[model samples]
Target: MGTSLLTNSSAMTALQTLSMTNKKLDMTQNRIATGQRVSTASDNAAYWSIATTMRSDNKALGAVQDALGLGAATIDTMYTGLNGTVEVVSEIKAKLTAARTPGVDRGKIQSEITELQKQLKNTGDSAVFNGENWISVDSNSTSYNSTKSVVSSFSRAGGVVQIDTVTVDLEAIKLYDKKADATPLTNVVTGASAGTLVAVAGNITVQVGTGATVNVATTTTSTLDSIAKDIMKLGIDGLTVAVGGGQLQFANRASVNGAPAGVTIVLNGGLTAPAALATAPATETGKGILDKSYDAYNGTAWEVFSVANIDISKLTDNAADLAKLETYIAGVDDALGSITNAATNLGAIKNRIGLQQDFVKALVDSLDRGVGQLVDADMNAESTRLQALQTQQQLGIQALSIANGASQSILSLFRG
Candidate 1:
């Protein structure tokens, strides 16, 4: 009944059918191409939002997994370093034990001990990562780090992640019990017939002449060891002096060898006549590999003292030396045991990280599945939809044709 072309039923019906067919085709293509049921807000507003969130969660979990892997590697490096250090310590212990045995050559042991010290220093100096030394400068802090703790973070899903700093305690390597003695010895001279008196600290060295000098090593705190060397020298020569009771007794030992009178005594290092000589015995003390301190776990702390401090002038045989060495070595062994325990603790931490890595890996897998469920399209369903859309488009075109046929009938009526 409408005259205007815009109001034509056939035209309106065809346009509506075409629009519906295009919409169905679009949905089918989206599912097939994107592999997603909800690709955009227009397709499914709420489902799209949920999928977006799930995808983000998966990314976060993946990141966490990466960081955890790196963390595990870091722990491995630390453990490897500790193991090397332990081997070095064990070698030192073995050498010390051998050195303590009877009939062992102590001179050889000293040489080996010096080598061991060099190795220890090398190990400390060589601890590094990425061409950078890992050794810490912080006092009372760990060797790997001053303040940061080793940590690894993981997400419930596979996503982005971060790694925390690691710290290793290097103090276990230090041996602190041994103390060094740095006191200088005193000198005293006695029994001089005509030489002028020179003052020395509890000891005196009389210089006789050039070339020849006699060295008299002394354990006495009141006397100096070099006094004899000074008074008996090459140039003046022929001069002979005997010293006792902190007194210098001068006699002409010079024969045709020369007149002892030709020698004049000069005191060096502040030696003086009338000086009283005193002696103190040297004692043995313990010396540690490093300047560090530790609490004893099994025995009394060890100390090193000079041999002169002990009452015996010398140990009569290797047997006696071995006994003394054993006593001191026992204390060192105890200290080393504590270090082993600390390393054991680090081992435990490494194991924990291993477990955590496993957990993170499983979590990442789970997150991956969740993200797939959120965004993945069903190919089978999309195939069915494509077939259905084709059928609908065919039907829509046929219906549009039928509506045009009705308009053609109206044209026939107009012809009549």
Candidate 2:
């Protein structure tokens, strides 16, 4: 192309090259400054969008991690409480076992047991974290929930987001419930009507109060009514024996010397005395109030007696009282087993939460690396490119200056 005074074609070409070089230099500088190859939709639309969404999901995962932490703390609290309760219940069991020996001061043993029971209650009540207590609960509360859920993870797939959770059954782990319908103290021991029947193959000696010993002969053909009639023939003051539902019932209705006198029925010759005769007498001596009937778990299917209500203070060395003591021990054992199972389950959950925490951390790191690969700039490469583009911009400016100087040559010709 021929040169023209107005056009200056060579200068125009150099000017265009310089402008393009400056734009490229500006872009390299921006990449270095932002540390991102795709900082915006204009840089790389698809990658920027993906990184934005991933960042949002990472925030959600962070919240899930917090939830997991809270859940772990709650479980740890419950486990600690259960472990302490196990120790206390074990102590109570030992005390009850010791009380089984004849001539042992059961009142002293019962005092120890009472303190242990208080400890159990305290442990249950205090096993709380973040205002949550799984050990002791009021089932009648409007907000009570047997199942507790903990947020575990946040996930996204095909543009859809979801949250995952772990759940625990509080009912299985709960030691006590304060529901109004719970079994009362009166039901701690089996009722008199519910006592074991007197079925023996020999004559049985019965002594009620201070009355003389009476022998009631029993044959295979002897009916409970006939036996009861023979005991009634003793004419003991304030003693009444009757047969009801094939079970013998005994009552002492008389007081002695202006004071209430208790009835004591002693049977020999391997004849099991009716539970009615063993019932806590009106005088309330030689009988513990807690020996009535107590149910743990608030009448759940387990139906074991409450360790907290076990009382051997007034229990004698008689067969019936000893038998009642045995029942108390069994109930405590059952409660211990249940608490142990709950602790095991809580431990497993704690382990799982730890594993999940590790997994979440790893997953978050992986996500960071992935987003980095998609959008983050390589500083080494960007710096090198920036240097090269700056050199190119300088060179383009020089070329444009040289091209514009060609117009000076044309001006010289005109002056000549």
Residue 220 of model 2 has an lDDT of 54
Worst 10-residue lDDT window for candidate 1 reads 293-302
Candidate 1 residue-wise lDDT, 1-416, digit = tens: 65443456766778798788879898788889988877888767877776787676656656656665665565455555545555665665676677655566666765665576566556545545544333212332243332234455533325444444345544433232223522211232442333344433432333332435333333334332134333433322123233434444342222222212122344443344322111211321122223222111111122233211211123234433544454334434543564566557667777877777687677767766776686678899889989998888888888788876665655665684
Per-residue error for 3 in candidate 1, Å, reads 12
lDDT of 2 at 83: 81
Clash number for each model: 66, 7
List the candidates' TM-scores in order: 0.57, 0.73
Segments of candidate 1 deviating more than 4 angstroms: 1-14, 41-46, 131-144, 155-291, 294-328
Model 2: per-residue Cα lDDT over 1-416, one tens digit each: 76687988888999999999888888888889898889999998999999999999988888998999999899888889888877777888889888989999999998988888888888888989999998788767899888999999999988788898889987668777765322211111112345434445666575544646667777756665566567766654344454433344454433444334445554433334444543334442111111222332211122324566776888888654664566566556656776788889888998999899999989999999999999998999999998898898889989999999987887777784
Overall local distance difference test of candidate 1: 0.48
